[model samples]
Target chain A: MRNILAIIERELRAYFTSPIAYVVLTIFVFLSGLFFRSILAQVLQMGLMSQLQAQQLGPRAMDMPGMITRGFLSTMSVILLFVMPMLTMGLFSEEKKRGTIELLLTAPLTDLQVVLGKFFAGVTFFIILLLTTWIPTGMLYLYSTPASGPILTAYLGLLLYGLALTAIGLFISTLTENQIIAAVLSFGTIMVLWLVDVLANNAESSTSKAVLTYLSILSHLDDFMKGVLSTSHIIFYMSLMLVALFLTYRSIDSLRWRG
Target chain B: MITVENLTKRYATKTAIESVSFQVEKGEILGFLGPNGAGKTTTMRIVVGFMPASDGTVRVDGFDVFENPLDVRRRIGYLPENPPLYPEMTVAGYLRFVAKIKGVPKEKIGAEVKRVMERVSITDVQERIIAKLSKGYKQRVGLAQALIGDPPVMILDEPTIGLDPKQIHEVRELIKGLAGNHTVVLSTHILPEVEQTCNRVVIIDRGKIVAIDTPQNLRFQLQGAERVFMEIQGPVPEITSKLKAMPGVIDVHTVGSNDGRHRFQIEGELKKDIRSDLARTVVQSGWGLYELQSASMSLEDIFLKLTTAEERE
Candidate 1:
């Protein structure tokens, strides 16, 4: 337990000591802020159009807070997809590149401690990233009364979704010593899983479509965004996270043998 | 104490170390001497639990490295050829982290880091970032990292490679000082380092140990005959012939000449002391005896001889 925290502390310092965390944070905040303003403007436009239509037709009610919550949740999910690789790309790759992996491997700490330490470090950074979004979401909560249930459920789903992606990035980082290669490979991999939904729609065979749709990384996310918390969707992301973490553990084991 | 038996590491392309076997006694400084690419690093890696041997058993402090790795690792400290350091961390910070991971208690981490830093004489630069430090300082920090937790055994690979001469001298002294309390296995291509620091030397060549012996014994065993170098200011052929006539002297030849003084290399029978006889013969013959000194085989020659002897076969 102490060894794991030691690793976690080292990793966190590594993240903040370098410009990686700041640059990723700034870009994420900037992009998310831009999307927030645009979504707010669209919501205002929709409210205006409905108000104008209500004077001519019968009275129609518009859920402004709900619209804002759903819009912000969906946009935040895509923004997270783009930024997660930056958070995890250097986890094992930098250690391998600088030859520090030997220190960890030769230390008294078990491989599981090291792996979980890194995974938790990445998760903690992802949580920090999630908290940054609260600035914009907090503005929504202050200006209007949005139902807290869907927003919290959506965030819970997004955290699971992010963990699975982080596991992918962490596993890929273990495969190579080059951070750029790790980043590009992880981005390409996550992109495929994200776009599987499109492939599912275009499939000619019903069974093939069903399998592809089930494999799509975003379809499960869509249910969470809609506030429909199904056990199967949660299970899918959990299983993916578990499998990726297991592969990362095995990769580290093989690295020791191959060394 | 560590024992390695039939250790071999075979990659897909070639074997790194082939059936290498050696043991390090408690409180012994074992110098692993080898040329570059001679599997010195590979053997140390396997011993330190940095990697696994293809077919072998490494028992460290009564625990097998492959089976009870944590037990073995707890007792050993390793410094690789390249210092395994996080460049962004401070020297003190890095040491503390290492101490923590090595299982030092939280209360003692402060003192452990300080102890290692003072041991390596890096306490002044403890606050400085590792990457900004010079190569010599970085090497010292790596040395300090290994000293943390005060493990029973230390494996240092080319510990003085990047340091300046003064730093190299200090590190050698430090390793020498670590003998009784901490068993050390240091690898190097520098022969003089092995001579000055190690109690026993393992000379590895081409992924195998060619020779393992005390420095003095290796020199004695490899030296076929006792040799004496002399500078005589007299007739070169006369001095050579006169020295060759001595009973214990096996052969004599003129080596070089300058300032009217000729250098003669006299080879005597094994374990014979012919320096006095050679000196007397030159002095009595009215030949000026400028210089006389015995020249034993240096470790460089033994290293070359052993490494190249395999090529001849």
Candidate 2:
């Protein structure tokens, strides 16, 4: 546990010492603000004020849960797609390139400790970036009657999305010593998952479409956006994270033999 | 203590090291002298548990390397050919991180880092970023990292490869000072570095152990035939005949002529001292004995002979 914490601290230091963390945070904030403004404009244009009055409630009494959920979920997912690669691209790639992997490999820490430590560090940084967007998210509570259920679900969904992407990014990082290659590969892989829903809609067979939909991260995230946390969706995201981490462990293990 | 038996590492069709075996007792500084591509780095990597051997067993402090790597790693410190350093980190940060990963107690980490920094004389630059430091200072930081935790065994690969002359001397002194307390196995292509710093030498060639012995013994063992080099102001044929006729003189050959002075190489039995006899013989024969000295083989020649002889066989 001490070794794991040491690795995590080292990784976090590396992240903040460079421009990566700042760049990721800046982009996340900009996108979140843009999405919040867009959602607010749409709410005003749809005359949610008069609609609530017709429902025998005050102008601010109507629940804007759907708008809040869609706005937060869509913006956070996009932000995560871009920020996660930056967070994880250097995890193992930089170590391999700088030859520090040998130092860590020969150290007293186990393989699990190194992989999990790096994984948790990336997740932690992602969470920090995700939490920063919550300031705008919390402001929605003042203007409209937003259901806390969907708000909580959206945050949970964003966390799962970030977790899954971090794992995949870490796995790709372990595949190469070139950070550019790792980032590009991770981005390309995530893009494919992002387009899985589109591909599924065009499928002729129900079974193939259902399979593709189940595999799509967006499809699972939709469940959380609707204030419903299905066990299957939770299991799906967690399993993907687990598999990516397991592959990362194996990649690090293979380095000792082939490096 | 470390013992490697029948160690072999083959990568697909290429063999890095094969059936190479050597033992290092406690507190012994074993110098691994080999040319580039001689598998010194590969063998060290295996011993450090960074890589697995294709076939063989390595025991460190009574623990098998493959089976109990953490146990062995806990007792060993390794510095590869390249110092594994994060350029963005300061020396103090880097060493502190190393101490943590190396399993130094949380409370003692600060003191351990300071102690190693002082030992390597890099305390002045403890706060300087590693990428901005000089190569010598970087190498010193690398050495300092290896000394963290005061592991009983240290495996240094080409530790002095890129250092300046002064830095090399300083590091050599540091390594020598480590003798009698840490079992150090350092690899280098520089022969004299080994002669100066190591108590014993293991010379490897083409992924094989060619010779293992003390520096003096290796020089002595490879000095097969006793020979004396002489420069005389006399006729070449006359001096050669006189020297060849001396007691215990096996053969004589005129090496070369310099400024009208003839030089002859006289070979004789190993146990004989032919210097005085050749001087007397040349002087009594009406020849001027300008210079007479015993011909000695250098470490380079011994290394070449051993490695090349193995190739021939």
Candidate 3:
């Protein structure tokens, strides 16, 4: 456990000492603020039209807070898919490039410790990125009353989604010594996971469509965005995270063999 | 102590090191001597548990490398050929990280890092980023990391390969200082480095152990003919024929002449000192003996003879 923490500490320092962390953080925050304002504006415009319609006819219920929060978070998730590759590209690739993986492999720590330590380091940075979004959401608390339960559940969903995506990015990072290649490959992978749902919509066969939709990462995230708490979505994200981490462990083991 | 038995490392299509076997007793400094592409790095990597050998076994501190790698790794400190440094990290930070992962006590890490930095004389650059340091300092930092946790065994591959003369001297002295307390296996192609620092030398060529013994022992074993350089004021033909016909003389050649004196190098059988007999012959023939000196074979000649001579056959 101490070995894991040492690795985590080293990895975290690696992220912060370099320019990559600051670059990713700045871009993520700026994009989130832009998305939040636009989603808020669209929600407000719809609310105004609805109110005007209610004044003309009878009153109709529309959960404005639900629509705004869901829209903002879904857009945020898509943005994470793009930026997460930057955060995880150097996790293992840099070590391999610099030949520092030899140190870790020769140390007393097991491959699992190194893998989990790096995985947690990426997750920790992802959490820091996720926290920045809270600055925009905190503004919601200042002006109007949003449903606390949906906000909580939505944050959980984003957390799980980010965890799963970060795991995928981490796995991809182990495949190459070039950070750019890792980043591009991770982006391609996450893009496929995100676009699978679009493919599902155009499929002619019901069975193929069902399989594609189920495999689509966003399909599992939809219920969480709608403020519905379900065990299946949680299981899906957790399982994906585990599979990615397992592959990372196996990949590092192979590196030891081939070195 | 480390024992590597019949170790062979085979890649997909070729062998990196084959049938390499040697032992480093407790507190012995074994120099792994080899030319480039001779598998020194591969053998060190396997011994330190960085990679597994394709066949045979390695036991470090009595723990089998393949079966009990963690136990073996815990007791060994390794400085790879490339130094294994993270360029972005400060030297102090890197060493601290190494100390921690090497399982030093939390409270002792600070002192341990400080001690190693002081030992390698890298204390001044402890706060500098590793990437920004000079190559010599970077190499010292690599050595310092290996000294962390004070492991009983150290495997250093080409530790002084890139250093300047002064730095190489300092590193050799430092490695010499490490003897009697830490068993060290250091690799180098420099012949004098082995003679000056190592208790025993293991000369490897083409992934095989060509010779393994003390520097003196290897010289004695391969010293087939003793050479002597003599300058005499005598006719070239008479001197050459007389020296060639002398007892214990294997071959004789006239090297050059200075004024009226002729220089010749004579080869005699091992353990034979023919200087007295040659001098008496020259004196009895009425010639002045200007110079007579015996030249012992250096480790360089021995290494070349062992490595290349095998290839020639």
What are the models' TM-scores? Answer: 0.92, 0.93, 0.95
TM-score of chain A of each: 0.98, 0.93, 0.98
Q: Candidates 1 and 3: which is better by TM-score? A: 3
lDDT of 2 by residue, B78-156 (tens): 9999999999999999999999998898899999999999999999999999999999999999999899999999999
Q: Flag regions of model 3 displaced more than 4 Å.
A: B231-247, B254-263, B278-290
Q: Which regions of candidate 1 are displaced past 4 Å?
A: B228-293
Looking at model 1 chain B, which ten-residue stretch has the lowest summed lDDT? B236-245
Model 3 steric clash total: 0
Q: For each candidate, report its DockQ versus the true two-chain complex.
A: 0.82, 0.77, 0.81
Please report, in order, the local distance difference test score of every candidate based on alpha carbons.
0.91, 0.89, 0.92
**If ranked by TM-score, best first, what sequence of candidates would result?**
3, 2, 1
Residue B221 lDDT in candidate 2: 79
Candidate 1 lDDT by residue in tens digits, B248-311: 8888888899999988888888888888877787788898888999999899988998999989
If you assessed candidate 2 against the hidden native complex, which CAPRI class would it receive?
medium
TM-score of 2: 0.93
Minimum summed lDDT over a 10-residue window in model 2 chain A is located at A57-66
Pick by TM-score: 2 or 3, better one: 3
| Quality class of the docking in candidate 1, CAPRI style | high
Candidate 2 regions exceeding 4 Å error are A48-62, B232-254, B266-272, B276-289
Clashes (N, CA, C under 3 Å) per candidate: 0, 0, 0
Q: Looking at model 2 chain B, report the run of 10 residues with the lowest lDDT sum.
A: B269-278
Chain A of candidate 3 scores what in TM-score? Answer: 0.98
lDDT of 1 by residue, A1-259 (tens): 8888889899999999999999999999999899989999999999999988998997887778878878887888888878888889999999999999999999998999999999999998999998888998888878888888788889989899989989999999999999999999999899999899999999999999999999998888887877788999999999999999999999999999898
